[model samples]
Target chain A: MTALLQVEQLEVVYQRAITAVQGISLVVQPNQIVALLGTNGAGKSTTLRAISGFLGLDDARVTEGAVRFKGERIETLSPQDITRRGIVLVPERDKVFPNLTVAENLIANAPRGMTLAERRRLHELVHQYFPKLAELKGREAGYLSGGERQMLAIAGAIVCGPALLLVDELSLGLAPVAVEELTRRLVEIRRELGIAILLVEQSAAVALEIADHGYVLENGRVVLDGDGPRLKSHPDIQEFYLGGSGERRSYRTVKQYRRSRRWYG
Target chain B: MQLYVNIAVLASIYALIACGYVLIYRVSRVLNLAHGELMMLGSYLLLTTASLFTGHPYLAFAAAALLALVVGALVYLFLLRRMTGEMVLAAVLTTVALGILLRGVMVLIWSASQQYPREALGWANPAIALPGGARISTFALLLILSTAAVYLSLFVFLRFSRWGIRMRAAGQNPLLAAQRGISLHGVYALAWGLSTFTGGLAGMLLAMDSGLDGTMVVIGLKAFPAALVGGLDSLVGALLGSLIIAAAEIFLIHHVDPLLSDVVPFLVLIAMLVIRPWGLLGTKEELDRV
Candidate 1:
């Protein structure tokens, strides 16, 4: 079967001089949670932005690759048009309208191809996933806790009825308990809605816990890629990302490990 | 009591005009310096429509209102659209240039004559005496009533309607709004339309009460300081600001010198700026955000 979403050797450039993402490729199958893990400036967020058609705001562009949604080229589409095409992104920051009430934030989403009745039903369904939101429906979103704001962000994206959801930095600024709860909710959302998610994160442990497939990025390139179990146990991921190794490896060995492509091939 | 009634009428006029500034500024962060010119243009359109739709006062008024809405939307579409991603200062300057151009064009067309639209529409500005020994002109009463209706409807619409919520969302964060599948251009165009429509209504009634000429633009300009004093982004602030400035203007003209009428609003504006630059109800963060 064909992939639900595909990014082929995508290259993103900022301000015509800085190339933030260099020839990175990935895919998400139907109902799968695919995690893109990288540290600061590793191009994980850029790749997601490129895929979700959100790079325009930052003067960034996907210069040398194709982002395909269900076999259709969509790299040139506007963000709202991309959303209408069923790929909605829950951005890293400023995720909810601060002044708007919680219920207004949920209803602000212009759902793709959903009737008013269907949209209301979807709102109720999302409220079920986060009952706390229902209770705080009338309260301003600005007054929400960080975890509740994250919940509202995710629920707001869910309101769009997306076929492919792009989540950027799901664990950033979140406590471990909150991250765990969010990851659990994500897994349940994938199972119930059958929506594919391309989750970009720096928290490898949290991401790998629920991701069906995973890729590790370093310096704008995908250095390693595999299924969750395989990548989780890889020594490099375990050492650098998962923080499993206590003893420091020699710098020479680390350089040699990066140069070797035996495991990637 | 008469003085208070006069102040109320003047305040309603300023409030009506100031809300237009608040609307466009809140959405796009553009000052729309041409708003006074646009407001004058609205009354001029009413004049032309009044002549064409002879003996049909209601029809002519409605037509002129609709035309004002289109004119505003067109201004955004043809001119302001290009400035969307430009610097705010440049956008504001563009509006200033547009205002000068509009004033020139209006002078050319109308010959700078003070025309009474009430005569064209065969309406009389009757003086109605209040029980409190105050008198209100017919158009002044309509202006006050229309201002109340506009404010109430705008309050409800912005709070309850889906698109209204979307407009507030867009105003707060344009990027997030676009990501949520909102068409920014559409929201902006709607705001411009509604703003110009309300502004036109104020202009038409004001022209009926007195008359319209280049001086009407000065009143429009005076009302802008009211918007800034109240908070450039808040409609309720505009109302309050208008009342404050109008009270100052009315009291100074009545008690001190009538010539002070032209300078009183700005004096109050300066005072507000010294105390709180963001206006009474405006968000402080908005100062840097703009």
Candidate 2:
């Protein structure tokens, strides 16, 4: 089977000068949860935006790369056009329409060929995933807690019936318990909807918790990639990202070790 | 009682026109100063269509209304579309320039004369006697009814319809709205079209009530303070603001000075700005963001 989304040698430059993302390549297979883990400024968000057609908003463009969705190039399309083609991004912040109520937020998304009955069924389905949202349907999204806001954001994207969902920083401002719950829900959503997800996050633990395959990005380049369990157990990932302890090593030693390590991809 | 009648009539007029300002401001965050000129153009269109369909006033009104809708959408599609990514101040200035251009073009086309649209449409403005012994023109009564209808329908449309929710979504977070597959330009164009259609309704009714002239634009300008006092983005605020300004203007005209009629709304607007700059119902965050 073909991949749902493929980003090849994607280099994004902002405002004609600063290169935000440099030669990043990734793919999201159908029904797969692909984790993109990186620290801030590692170009994780930039790569997601590039795939979701939001690069133009920040005066950024794919200077040397291609984003293919269902075997069609989409990096040059408008955000709306890209979204209509089933690549939806749940952005890091301002994820929910603040003034709109939870129900309105769900309804506000552009319906992706869903009949009224089907849309209603999907609404009920979303409510099933997040019962707290159903309880606060009339409350404005601005007043929702961070977790609830995240739920609404995901629900909004789900309503679009996207083939590939790009979620940026899902655990950014949520409590650990909230993050765990949301990550569990993400797994359920992927299984039920059978859609691919490219999950971009700073928290390796939260992302790799359910990701089928994972890639580690450093300075806008993929430094390592493997199956979820393999990446989780990798010495470098365990020490740096998962924060697993190593034999009382000094920071300088770890830095030297990091510099010496090289990928054979 | 007469003062109340006058205030209600004036309030109705301001509310109808102010909604146009609110609609455009809410969706695009751009103050359309050209709305007054567009309103006047709607009245002039009525005149042209009326003369064209000499024996059919309803057809003329419908044709003129349709033209107004098209003109408003075209303004966004052609002129204001270029100003989309610019600073808010620059966009406002573009509208100011557009208003002047429209004014000059209108004068060159229709001439700067007081033309009676009622006469052009073969209709007469008759004074209706109220139960409380207040005399209001028939068209003033229609204005009140039309204002009620417009506000009711707009409230329903914005609160319930999917497109209306989309418009609100677009206004609140344009980038996110675009990310969700909403065409921002389509939403903006729809807002402009609706704003002008309602403004044109106000202009047509007022022109039918009184003879059309250059001063109609001033009346449009005066109504903008109502929009500001109510909040630039809230339709409910617009209605309440119009009532407040209308009451102040009528009371000042009768009790203080006749000349205060023109200045009272602005004075109230300034007072509102000082006390509550975001207007009564407006979200406080909107001012800071804008």
Candidate 3:
């Protein structure tokens, strides 16, 4: 498969003597879903942000690196330039444009090249992936629930017709069932749209299960990199985190959530 | 008929100046507190150009507008760029200083004279009737035409152009718009350019309606009431606000005591501030930003 986007020794620095990310590099090939897994502050999110160019005010700088998309250096480019060039980012925390309606939000980021018919067809593609979004078309994004908001964020990125999509922390605060559903849809989208994805997640088990390849980051460095199944079975990963499989625990937690919901009612 | 024409002529010029405040303040989210002084500066520039004409009024107006564009660009680059991301206080104060500067320069250049237009006094005498029993003269028709042309072209330009979309985006979220490759400097320059362009035109027209003097700067001050009452964010709101003020001034000149004449704009201003601070047509989201 052709390399859609590639990075080399990317470094992102924050203002206050803190290096948010130091020399991390990854690739997103067409139809590839590469997962970067670590606990909070492992710089996974920072790495993703540097790629998206959401570097906030002050001396936040991409001190050194080359992020090439379609063989052009894009590390120093603006976020909207990156977006316009077809590398879309769905920011963590399910951040959809709050004031805009779901449809307006989608249309705002939508790629502008087609006849009305093709535009509707692309709209149908998003609806197919997150059918629930179709019903909430006219509703303001601020009013969406956690799951629906995530769906909208995903839909917004896809609308850009990006060659590579960066998704940061897809499961942060999401329900277990919702995470599973979102993961399934993500793989489906990678297949259908033929867009490479670089997904950063805090959870190892869920991340490894859906990922074709995984990079295990510890502190500011990559500790392990391998095929998803091999990394999932690695002893070091189990020793530091994951703690054997989390399936049984997630299932119990799902049941507990239902019971709590019932009791609150 | 001539007397009837004079009111309409003056009213349209008032509306044109009022609308400039509406456009920049509404879209750029700056009060443009110096707008009145800028108009005064523009009029003086017009007068200087018109003095060269001796009898050619049209040439004077055109030259004033052209030169005003260069002045607008200079203000945007030198004054406004420094204050771009500054707080409302800084932006407001900068414009206040700009007003003082413009006034200082006007005195330096023109020596504070009360000057009459080169055209003959008989120019105000011609008149034409409207279907509703209102009548207009040549001066009145020209004023109405210019006013209509300014607003209409601005309305269509902003509504239809790609640059207008960028301006809207910049107004909404400057950072995001910048990220989208819109040059913030360019947008500010365009805003100031439009502001000064219309400002010069309005000043030239008003000077034609009456004689030019140093205190003619107050006409721009009066425009604030119009912009404020109409809602700074809505283009049409300025026109509505100005019409109300003009009507109040016209009817009050003889009907109400002259002592209370200046109080009318203030009264309407206070009422809107208390009742509907957003004005007649300002979008609701602007309230939160304020």
Candidate 4:
């Protein structure tokens, strides 16, 4: 089957001097949950932004390579146009329009054209996934707690009827219980809606638990890629990402640790 | 009673013009310094339309109003669209330049001399005396009525309509709005169109009440302080600010010095800035950005 979304040898440059993402490529099949795992500044967010058509806002651009969605070139489209093509991004920060009431926030999203009944059904679906949102519909989003805001953000994206969802840093600054609940909801959403998700996450344990497939990014390159079970068992992942080793090391070994990992492409 | 009537009339005028400022700023966070010129342009369009549709006064008025809306949208599409991702200061400066250019072009086309549009439209300004011996011109009453109609509709639209909610969404977080498939350009253009539509209405009414002249732009500028005093982003603030400024101007002119009429709004603005920079109904957090 054809991939739902494809990023081929993508190179992103910021302000014409800084190379944030260098020649990295990935794919997402329809209805699949794919996690992009990385540490800080690993070009994970940049890759997602490139696919979501948000690089222009940061004075960054996909200088080389292509982003294709359903066999159409979409690297240069505006964010709204990209969204209309059914790729909705839940960004890392400023995820919701803070001043808008929760109900108004849901109403503000422009879903693909649907009948009145379908719109109502979609609304019901969102409220079903996040029942608390229904109760807080009258409250302004700025007043919502971190977990509630994340739920609202996800709910808003779901309202757009996206075929491919891009979530950046879903578990950041959230309680572990909240993260577990959100991940469960994400799985349920994917199963029910049959939409592909490209989730960028820092926590390997959280992401690997839900992701069907995963890619490990380092220094703007995809250093590793495998199915969920294989990646979860990989030694490097266990030692570095999952805190498998309990023994302490000196500062010199700590500084030279990254060179020791056997990264495979 | 006459002083109260004067205050009401002046307050209505300021409120009508001030909402234009509030609408654009609230959406795009750009201060349209050229709003005065745009308002003047609306009056000038009425003058042109008046002559074109002579003997059809109502048709002329409607056509001019429609033209003002189109002109406002066109301004966004052609000029401001280019400045979207740039600094807010740059966009504001562009408006300043646009204002200067519009002023020069208006003078070149219509000349600097005062022209009466009411005569051109074959309409007469008749004053109706109130019970308390206070007289208000027919256009002044129309201005007050229209201001009420505009504010009422705006509140309803922003509060309940789908597009209105999108506008509020776009204003608060443009990036999130875009991600949800809301076109920023469409929202911004709509804002410009609505702002110019109301501003043009104020200008046309003022022109009809008194007479069209170069001085009409001064009225537009004077309304800016009223908008600032209420808060730049709130519709309620605009109305309240206009009333406060108008009351102070009228009362000070009546009690202190007549010449204080021109400086009253500014004085009130400076004091408001010092005391409560966000204005009465404005969001307090907006103080840092503005």
Task: Give every collision pair in model 3.
Answer: B128-B136
TM-score of each: 0.98, 0.97, 0.72, 0.97
**Model 3 B-chain TM:** 0.88
- Give candidate 2's total backbone clashes: 0
Ten consecutive residues with minimal summed lDDT in candidate 1 chain B? B281-290
Q: After superposition, how far is residue B168 of candidate 3 from its true place, in Å?
A: 2.4
Name the DockQ score for candidate 2: 0.82
Best by TM-score: 1
Q: Which lDDT tens digits does candidate 2 get at residues A1-265? A: 7778888999999999999888888888899999999888989999988888888778888999899999999988988999999989999999999989999999998866778898888888899999999999999999989999999999999988888899999989789999999888888989998878899988998888899999888877888899999999988888888878846788898787567444523
Report candidate 4's interface RMSD in Å: 0.8
Candidate 4: list runs displaced more than 4 Å. A250-257, A260-262, B288-290
Error of 4 at A170 (Å): 1.1
DockQ category of candidate 1:
high
| Candidate DockQ scores, in order | 0.82, 0.82, 0.16, 0.86
Tell me the spans in candidate 2 whose CA falls farther than 4 Å from its real position. Answer: A246-248, A261-265
Question: Better model by TM-score, 1 or 4?
Answer: 1
Docking category for candidate 3? incorrect
Which candidate number would show the highest DockQ if scored against the true structure? 4
